[model samples]
Target: MKLLKTDGIVIKKVDHSEADRSLTLFTKNFGKININISGIRKSKKRHLNGADLFGVSNFIFYKKEDYYILSSFELNETFFDLRKDLEKLNISFHILEILNSVLVENETRIGLYKLLLNSFRFLDKNNKPIKNYLLLGYFLLLLIQGEGIMFNINDGLYFDIENSIINDLPTFNKLTEIQKIIISNLFDKKINDIVSLDPSVDDAKSIILLLEDYMNYHLNLKINFKEFF
Candidate 1:
């Protein structure tokens, strides 16, 4: 059998056969995959720290009898500090859950992989606050597109971007128009570029909450969108 190597991040790790572990990895070349990591619990083979959650690594695995067995792995970036903080940890977990829900196993999506990696780095950089809603609105917009969900915005005036398209504008018409532009612009941004936007706290909250609602409607996510707010 031929061995394949790719850069991937661990999404899940589960105990198997006492010594062996089963891991789900989101990879650059293969998208998502399940591989058996043998003898990991034995102290001699414990050097593979890439088996932990959010561990990014270069993995070499070979298929045998239609199942994959990991041969070797070298840790790249564990985002360990991001894991230590409660807020960052929770956001990162939600990101993982969103990715797991939308992607299918063994489907190659290099763009999606890059987006996921950059998002992890952004969280780790501590360049911005975790709950202040940096790039999340834009990220969800891209995730919806990546997952092949179809949607259109008509002359549909949206009073609340989360709820529905409404024709009537409230008394704060100018403010509403500006926010509507913000929501629309989210779809046009690259994942990393979205962090540059500076909106008022009130506007940011509404925009983020609304985007979450929009994603919830389309993806039917198992994780609650409200928790991110």
Candidate 2:
């Protein structure tokens, strides 16, 4: 009976009825939600792009009993360029997959939402493959931080995976020099300055893979990004 409006990005979509579709959106106020949109599949022209994955839009909906039914939507951004480049599209989906995996339904994560939007905007504008990987590393670090695991990368000697900190002595998880530098810079530098690090593709992947381990240990998320690489 109550109409609600919020800014959301489509993270998943699936065919429902012949004319309706089901979508999973990560909204600014409500976090992840599943809503059914009618007539989109049959009449694709009016609602197709707005309902597509990775498009940010303002959505209007209302709850009917237990289901949220879509009333309308206005597309804000499609991040169209991401669709043009295969690699960019792959990387973007990788980020989205992580988001879809970690986000609990109806739990608001304002910081993570902002980080996701900004990372998409950044990835949309930049064409450098290395920069894209660096952004992925940056996004992953922030995602971990959002979970309250602060990674202390000061002059990195050894990473304490158990405590999620960096220390002078060797720990069970040893980080390479390049991985240490990349992690430190990602946390310390601004978005514009990240590209200045200009890490090799391999180096960038090393940092991301290291962070992936942290994700598994701390968050219990096992994401295999091998296909994207």
Candidate 3:
């Protein structure tokens, strides 16, 4: 067995036994890996907190054949404030679910992990009516990073979702000038600035749906959660 120590984010956790959990972690060095975390349930207060969904930690584990066994973990950030509101919590889960679905095991995506962590921090700090849109923006950023899409801010060009390029303007009957501006800015603006804009809930939802479809088409993965609203 090869022992390793690294920083990771908890992507998913499932109870395997009375006191053991099967966890999926996205690590800085090792990418995503499945690990068996024992004794969490028995610890109740302490270990349980470190193993929560969206928890970032420094973990010690040992690799054995195909899987990793988690020996110890030090909690970094739980993003606990997200739990204070039900809606925010739901949005956070949606973000994690998308990542869990797309990110492959043993594929290094250190940049994506950093983006997710920063987005979670933004959610915890900011107050915006369209919180889901902010998360959707981060999702779009990840898609752009993974797909190698070009974003041109100065020209106000839109992404040809099918081609994954910023050449053609978006063609949707319902999109207004303001909505187009918002989408353009999404492709160009800084993460913090984009999240601070207060678009109406309906408008935000519409943009998010369109972007989700674009991502689905490019990634060849159906995003069924777009129908949640």
lDDT values of the candidates?
A: 0.71, 0.84, 0.73
lDDT of 3 by residue, 85-128 (tens): 67677677777777887888999888887888887887776576
State which candidate, 1 or 2, has the greater TM-score.
2
- Scored by lDDT, the top model is 2
For model 3, what is the alpha-carbon lDDT of residue 140? Answer: 68
Of the pair 1 and 3, which is ahead by lDDT? 3
- Model 3 lDDT, residue 209, Cα: 69
lDDT of residue 131 for candidate 3: 63
Local accuracy of candidate 1 as per-residue lDDT tens digits, 1-229: 7999999999888887878889999999988999998788874744556888899999999989868899899889988778777767767777787787878888999998998888888787675662225455566767767776634544444443333443454422223654666666666664243345555556655666665555666677664545654
TM-score against native, each model = 0.79, 0.91, 0.85
- Model 2, 84-116: lDDT tens digits are 989889889999888888899999988888888
Whichever of 1 and 3 has more TM-score, that candidate is 3
Deviation of model 3 at 10, angstroms:
0.7
> Rank order by TM-score, top first?
2, 3, 1
